[model samples]
Target: MAKIKKGDLVQVITGAKQDRGGDRGKQGTVLEVLKDSDRVVVEGVNFVTKHTRVGQSARGSREGGIETVEAPIHISNVALVDPETKKPTRVGHRVEQVEKDGVTKTVRVRYAKKSGKDL
Candidate 1:
């Protein structure tokens, strides 16, 4: 199971502080997870400017320009936010058994160690 998943709230744990115009301490939703590359794209974080060629679509609408978009950041640089305290916290997993339809199954679930709340 992944510690960080899409839609999870996370805070930048590394890099320059926000006072220095960096993203550190900034919290945002996890937009995407690049497992193979060990990177994650967080909303409103790690923004990069893209200069695209100006062109027109089939409908004759102008397209493409200098746009700032979120870029992927190393997964280690982010920490999941604890729902209770609203602070960054380490994740821990625990296995639990649940019965449904007369069947019991074991499932690994992630929770925040700080608040002991399920993630």
Candidate 2:
């Protein structure tokens, strides 16, 4: 199981302080996970501007222009937020048993170690 998954709330643990115009300490939902690159894009974090060639749409309306979007950040730089404390915390996994169709099955589940809350 992945420690951090999409829709998980995460905080920037490494970066310039927020007072310095950085995202450190800021929390946001994980928008995407780039597994191949070991990176994750957090919503409202790491904003970057994109410039596209000016063009016309099929309806003759204005097309491309400058746009701002979130950029992917290294996964290590973020930590999962603890629901109880509203702070960053490490994730842990445990095996749980459940009865399905009269059969007991073991499943691996992720949880927040800080508050022992299931994730």
Candidate 3:
């Protein structure tokens, strides 16, 4: 499994709209992981319009028309952002020791390659 996970910060790397302009280099956190489909839904990215019909619950809702919602983008298209540098970076894993109750245990952790800091 990839070290990347939900809540990890990421920036888009490729795509027509992504390459063209605004928010292309913007960073956001991963909201959900669609591992079966090899896709991830990033917060505030790949927005699409959705049309909804009037329902009993939303009878008087004026904002029931076409609504734009963020769509899922492929996980491969995004690079994880390093917390230290606050810039996009690739993810790698390493084992680190932590002490608890006078005992040490190795735990997998993420580190920022750019800043050489543990994330």
> lDDT at 63 for candidate 3?
44
lDDT of 3 by residue, 13-49 (tens): 7765555754567578999999899899888888888
| Candidate 2 lDDT for residue 17 | 85
Per-residue lDDT, model 1, residue 102, is: 100
Q: Model 1 over residues 3-92: C-alpha lDDT tens digits?
A: 999999999989998999999989999999999999999999999999988787788977777999999999999999999899888989
Question: Candidate 1: TM-score?
Answer: 0.88
Q: By summed lDDT, which 10 consecutive residues of candidate 3 come out lowest?
A: 110-119
How far off is residue 56 in model 1, in Å? Answer: 6.4
TM-score of each: 0.88, 0.87, 0.77
- Candidate 3: where are CA atoms >4 Å away? 17-23, 56-63, 115-119
Report the CA-based lDDT of candidate 2 relative to the real structure: 0.91
> How far is 78's C-alpha from truth in model 2 (Å)?
0.2
- Name the lDDT of candidate 3: 0.78
Shift of residue 76 alpha carbon in model 3, Å: 0.5
lDDT of each: 0.92, 0.91, 0.78
Clashes of 3: 0
